[model samples]
Target: MSDGATTRVVIIGGGFAGINAAKVLARDRRIAVTLIDRSNHHLFQPLLYQVAMAGLSPADIAVPIRGLLSRFRKVSVVQDTVTGIDLEAKQVSATGQSWSYDYLVVATGARHAYFGHDEWESNAPGLKTLSQATEIRRRVLQAFESAENEEDPEVRKELLTFAIVGGGPTGVELAGAIAELSRSTLTKDFRRIDPRRTRVVLIEAGPQILAAFSAASAVRATRDLEELGAQVWTESLVTDVSEDSITIGNDGEKLRTRTVLWAAGVHASELGSALSGELDRQGRVPVGADLSVAGHPEVFALGDLARTEDDSGAVLPGVAPVAMQAGRYVGRLIRAELAGKERRPFRYVDKGQMATIGRSKAVVETGRLRLGGFLAWAAWLLIHIYYLSSFRNRALVLVQWAWSYVTFGRGARLIVDREWRNPET
Candidate 1:
């Protein structure tokens, strides 16, 4: 490989896949890696719901990307938005600069899709980035503030009602956290209207929420949500979302609410289109078993940007573990190829999945084992804390969670951006 010359590797997107790949490549001094991302920080997206729910601050679930890779002398981090990629020229065009690489890794993640209803995003924000999470937090917390000063009962009811579209983990977790925030945390804090009377409606277009999980687990989660005083509506589709109302199903049943959060569907990053290969319906690039694009071995895609499959021919879900594993695998594969060793096909080890419903409610599935309630919640907590980017963040989150569990108090509930004017007015 280049007769022992330095090999430049450019990785786009400082997500789990890109970061992990850089970490693997850093071990080899021959490979100089440059990682680029739009954000300065590497966001722990699974806990983004916590930020939106005001349970954890943005810093708690994010770490500076530069800081993560600073210790690796061979790796350099750049914060810039990637605009285009030229596979033939082996160059990447960013905001005002371009980078040439011997090998390229594209791991730019997915964003929330509105299912052709892009205009609804102004009224209903989806949680993906830190900004989106904080925006949701502002809207959720602001709704209560607005409801407190409203004199009309109907207006107050509308303000107190929160609707979440999509019943996936994000939607389910959001519904549970909002329920707890209104019923328990803000119960005694508010005066004019009863916070405990707040309504949380989870609308799912599919027959069941968390379809990725087992049927029993989905049922348990739905029951747990219902117990938290949140309504679960299945087989319902949202036709339209307005400033203060949402029309669902063919009958156009309208729900009046100032707050609506979208967690329904997500398409791959638009960068997938910049590549040469044919993209799937979700805009994911079709990658071979080696995680390389068809006809372009030097160009690789990972995480949500690529549609990867397991040895069993089952398409792998775009999750953190899959991305992390793929990143490590790609890094090692590159190293092996450079060293003139045999390259191995990427094989993801199934690590199972878990989702937390509330404080002590959760569901976990690993191989043939299944768990729910407190034990599952404990597993979820430990696993998430362990996966946090930095030890300081983990400790901070653990302490905050412990304090919240003991006192039913959320310390990061400060609303930063204030919208004074009422939506209806």
Candidate 2:
């Protein structure tokens, strides 16, 4: 404790790292902790696409921050947006309130990055928040609705074309789910335009999709995506995006589309750059071995917001396991501090990595084991359900999966949004 009083540790961003770390820190009675984030709920971000695709609902993947700590008296949860961090004062000012802390943990996670083309954000929005996912669902369903009334084939094709930039997990999942949605869910509903003929493109600047995974697995996933009727374009760079179309490279050529969904690049949250520390090109702070920002003993960073290499010097992938392990470590380090013990440098223990391409197409990579296809898909399902916030969510997601498997259809596919009434138009 500072000045022989209670030490306060304030954590910013109530993401996986912040929430888990807060849970650990609050277990101790020696210090007081405050967890802050813009949202009142901790989101299961990996499953956000499910919500967007109508496989799940908002309440399925999120738990309110205030309700999570009903039994923990030491942990205080605050919902607010942090504008900046005052390193000198060791205080966090957000929502017109200033919170003082003896130590700080910066877990503010990432937002979608537009890669210096801020204008593109307006035309092709990215899905990083629950609101964005809901908006995308609304736009997607609205596209079908608008196409039903339009007579122009050109406009109809534009409405049918769904372009996803970046062949990463989000893009791949979206393409697959939307493919299923078109071929299965909306098949009998649309009479004018064939949702089956809907052109979904997964564009990537890299040579292959799932660049972080094994090349062979990426190849398998590519084949699976092709089977699912998604045009997987590798080495295809996007030049521009608009409401009517997107300009993407096509085998030394160019092509256009109506809708564009950005799954391309996502840097660390802006909170990383606001800190008084050396930031990497991706906006991740180069955390010390112990996960502390350089020259700032009171401040620590983890999750997507931190860039820390392992003992072999290979930087860990920005995956969920990495965040969980880092959160556990930082919590221990803070506990050591409270006990008046010297904290050791953090060492990462990589569990493994897996990505699901579609329902039955997945890839799992561990130390020496590599699994793909249905086996990998099963593994992915179990792992995701295991990590989900509550048993209720796990059960609901499992039921949804089983129902989808048998019926070859999706539930919760509704376009719920405020009706547009444009006065200017």
Using Cα atoms with residue i matched to residue i, what is each candidate's TM-score against the true structure? 0.97, 0.94
Model 1, 278-394: lDDT tens digits are 898788998999999988899899999899988778889989999999999999999999999987889999889988897889999999999998899999999998898464668
lDDT against the true structure, each candidate: 0.90, 0.81
Best by lDDT: 1
Off by over 4 Å in 1: 1-4, 389-391, 418-425
Each candidate: RMSD to true structure?
3.1, 3.1
Q: How accurate is candidate 1 locally (lDDT)?
A: 0.90
Model 2 alpha-carbon drift over 4 Å, by segment: 1-4, 249-254, 419-425
lDDT of 2 by residue, 174-282 (tens): 8887777777788898778788888888889999998887898889888888788888989888877777877766533445566678888888887887674578778
